[model samples]
Target: MARITMKFGGTSVGSPEAIAQVADIVKHTVDERHEVLVVCSAMSGVTNLLTEGALTAAAGNPTRYQAIATHLREKHSNAIRQLLPSDVERISIRDEVDSLIDEFETLCYGIYVLREASHRVMDKVTSLGERMAMPIISAALRHNGVSSTTISASYLIVTDDQFQNAGVLFDDTERRIRRELVPVLAQRIVPVVTGFLGATRDGVITTLGRGGSDYSAAILGAYVDSDEVWIWTDVDGVMTTDPRVAPDAQVLPVLSYGEVAEMAYFGAKVLHPKTVQPLVDRNIPIRVKNTFNPSFDGTLLTHEEHVTPSTVKAVTAIRDVSMITVAGRGMVGVPGIAARTFAAVAKQNANVLMISQSSSEQSICFIVPEEKSASVVESVQDELAHEYGRQDIQRTWADDDVEIVTVVGAGMRATPGVAARVFGALKEASVNVLAIAHGASDYSLSIVVRAADTERAVQSIHRLVVLNGISPNVHAPEPIKNAVS
Candidate 1:
C-alpha cells in the first residue's frame, strides 16, 4: 500500500455537497488500502471575506464584520446539516462552528478597538478560514464512515517569525510531524490537517503568504515521505495555455520539474510556485487532479525525464506589468551601474522579474509588478542621482502598457530553431516584441509585448509550438551516397 498525501483546494471543499464528494473520494482511497493524509484549504471565498472583514474592522467599523461572521456561521451550519449523516455529529459540529465564529468575532472586535491591523494580527485573522474548514471536513468524513481527526498545522510545522510570509523551519517541523502524525497514521485514522497557517517556535500564528495551502501540503508530504502528493483543484490539469487565450488548449499529461517551474514562474496557475521545492529532493511526484472529474487522468509532475513530442510545451503570459527602462550614455562603461540599480530595487523590497541589457552596455531594462514601478523607479533614480546630474544617464521611467509572454519547455534546450519558430509565430500574428530575455538554462524564452497583444501572442505561439509540433532539423550525412554506390 502506498502512502499518499491528498490536498483539496478551496473549490474541492467549498460546500456541503462538495464536502460530501470529498468524503467519498477519501473513503475510496482508504478502501484502496493507502495511508491517507488529508490537507484542506478554506471554502471558496472565505479567506477573501475574512481579509476584507479584517480590513473593515481596521478602518474603525467593527459592525461590518459582524454580519460577515453571521453569514459564515449560517453557511457552515447549513453544510453540516445537509451533509452530515448523524444528528449527534451535526449538533456537535454546530457547537464547534459556534465557538469558532465567536472567536472570529472577538478577534475582529479587537482589531476595531485597536484601529490598526498589524501583520501578525492580520495573519491570525485570515487563518481562521482554514481553521474552520478542517474540523468541518473531519466531521463530514466521520459521517461518511471514515474515522478521522482534525489537526492544526501550527503544531506540526514550525516556522520563523516572518508574520505574513513566514518561512518553515523544516528540521523542527519534520521531527514534530514524525513524533505527532506518524502515530495517528499508524492507527489508520485519517488525519485531516489545516493548510495555509503555521506557528513560530514561540507559538504565534503566522501565514505562509499567498497560495500557502499548496505549500502546506508540499511541506507535510515531504516530512511524511509520501510516495505521491495529489493536489485536487478545479481545473483538469496544467493546460498548454489559458483556454481563454487559446480555445483549443489541451492539458499536458506529463511534465518535468523544470517545465512546471518555468510554467509556474511564467503565470501558470494550476500549482503553487513553491509546491515543487520540497518534493524535488525527495523525488516525490505531485499530481494535479480535478476533484469534479476524478475519472480523467490529470497531469503527473515529476523529476524524471519523459519522451516529449514537441519542442515547446506551452505559452503563458503575465499581464498588467510595467517595464522600467534606464538608459544613458554614462552607463555605457559603468562598472557598478547594474549592481547599484538592483541594489536600489532590493532596498525598496521590490522584485525585479525579468531584466535585459543592451549588448553595447548603454542601457538596461527590467520588469517589475505594475504597482511597484513607482518605488522601483524612485530607488533607481536616487541611486543614480549623481549620474543624472552629470548627464551620464538619460532618463529612468516605467512603461505600464506591457505584459510578459513566456514559452516554456525542457525540449527546447535540445531543439535548434525553437527561438526562430517562436519569433516567427509572433511576427505572423502581428505582435510587436518590446523586450526579450532568454536565460542561460534554456528553460524559457520570455518576451515583453504590448498588453493588448498578449492573448494573440500566446495563441499564435501555442498553435505553432503545441498544435503543430515544430520539430528540430536533422541532417543525414553523406553516408547514403556510399550505400547508393
Candidate 2:
C-alpha cells in the first residue's frame, strides 16, 4: 500500500470505452488500498485536430477552426453525458469542457487576425486536449464510485517561460506541488491530473515538448515523493527492440536508469528521456505497463539495477537520418569554428542529431534528418564564408539512406565484449557500419548504417546480441613494439 502516480497516453484514453478501461485499472489500484494519482493525455486525434484547426485559421479561414472546436467540444460533452448519470455532475463536466473550448476559439481568432503562430499562443492552443480529457476521465471514475477529482496539470507543474520544451524549475515546482497535493493525498481523494502541460509563474501555458505526458508523470511522482510512477501505454512494455521491425524483439523485465535513458535517446518509444531525469535524481522507480493488460507485471526501471548475465535488454533504431561532415584545413586551429557552425545550423531550426569531432580539430561531423540536409549544408557554408572569409571550408553530406541502430542493456556495462558482438552480428549480415558512437557508460552502443539495410541490421544484431546471448570473440594481445620507430 504505497502512493503511486499513473499516467495514460492518448490511445489509452481515446474514447469512452478507452476511458472506462483506464477507470477499471484505477479502481483496482485504489481497491488495493494504494493512493493512486491518475494523469491522462487527450483522446486520440484530438490534439492533431486542434493543430489542424490552428493551421487552417492561420491560413486566413476561421470557420474551420470554429467548426473543429465545436465538434470537439460536443464530442467531450457527449462522452460526459454518456458516462455520468448524475445531472449535476454531467452539467459540471460539460461546463468545464465548454470553457476550455471557448479558450480555443479565442486563440483561433488570434491566429486568424495575426496570421502567425507564436510558441506561447500555441502552447495555450494545444493544452485544450488535456484540459478536455481530465474532466471526462474524472467523471468516469466517479461514475464507477471511485473518489476522483480532475486537476489541471498547469496549476501543478510549474515551468519557465520557454513555451515548448520548457525547463522545469524543480525547486519551485516541487514546493508548490507538495504543498497543494499533500492535502488531497491525505484525504485519499484521487487527483486525476492532465499530463503534458504546465504553466509559468505568471500563469502562461507551456508544454514539455514532445512526449511531455511521460515527463509530467515523472515530475509529479518526484515532487510528491511517491514510491513509484507507472506509465500505462498501448505497448506491453519496453521491448528488447522495436517489435515492428524485429519480430523477435522481447520485453525487458527490468532495466537500469542508464539503460533506459540510452534506449529513450536512441529511439525507444516507451519512455521519454526528460521523464527519467527527475526519477533518477530522486531515485524513484518507474514501471511501464500496458493499459489493457492490467495483470501483467510491466518492466521496472531503477537506479543501478543489476542485469542478468549474457542477456540483451532491447534493440532500438531510428531511420531516415542524414550524416553531414564539415572538414577543412582552416578548422585545424580554429577556436570558435565549432560554435559558429552549430549556431548556423540552429538558426535554420535544424536539429543536430549526433556530433563527432576529430582529435586534430580538422573536421567535425553531425547527423540530421534527410529533409534538412541541404538547408543545413547551405547554412553552414554561408556562416563559414561570412565569418571567416574562408572558401576552404568543405561540406559533404552522406547517406540520406542511413539509420541509427542502438542496443541497450545494463549488463553490457559490466560484461566485456558487448561492442564486439554487436559489430560481429552486423558483419555476419554484410551490413556496413558507417560510424560508431559509444559513451563511457558502456550501457549502449550506436551505429549508423544505410537506411535500406536498417531492418536487416536490426534483425541480425537482435539474433546475435539478444537471442544467442553470446559475446563476440576477442583477439589475443599484440606484442609491445620498440620505441625506435
Scored by lDDT, the top model is 1
Candidate 2 lDDT at 470 equals 27
Candidate with maximal TM-score:
1
**Cα misplacement distance, residue 438 of candidate 1 (Å):** 0.6
The local distance difference test score of model 1 is 0.86
What TM-score does model 2 achieve against the real structure?
Answer: 0.90
User: Residue by residue across 382-410, what tens digits does model 1's lDDT show?
Assistant: 99999999999999999999999998887
Steric overlap count per candidate: 1, 4
Runs in model 1 lying further than 4 Å from the true structure: 470-485
Query: Model 2 — which ten-residue stretch has the worst lDDT?
Result: 476-485
User: What is candidate 2's CA lDDT for residue 428?
Assistant: 95
On residues 166-189, what C-alpha lDDT tens digit does candidate 2 reach at each position? 878888888888987877977888
lDDT of 2: 0.81
TM-score of each: 0.95, 0.90
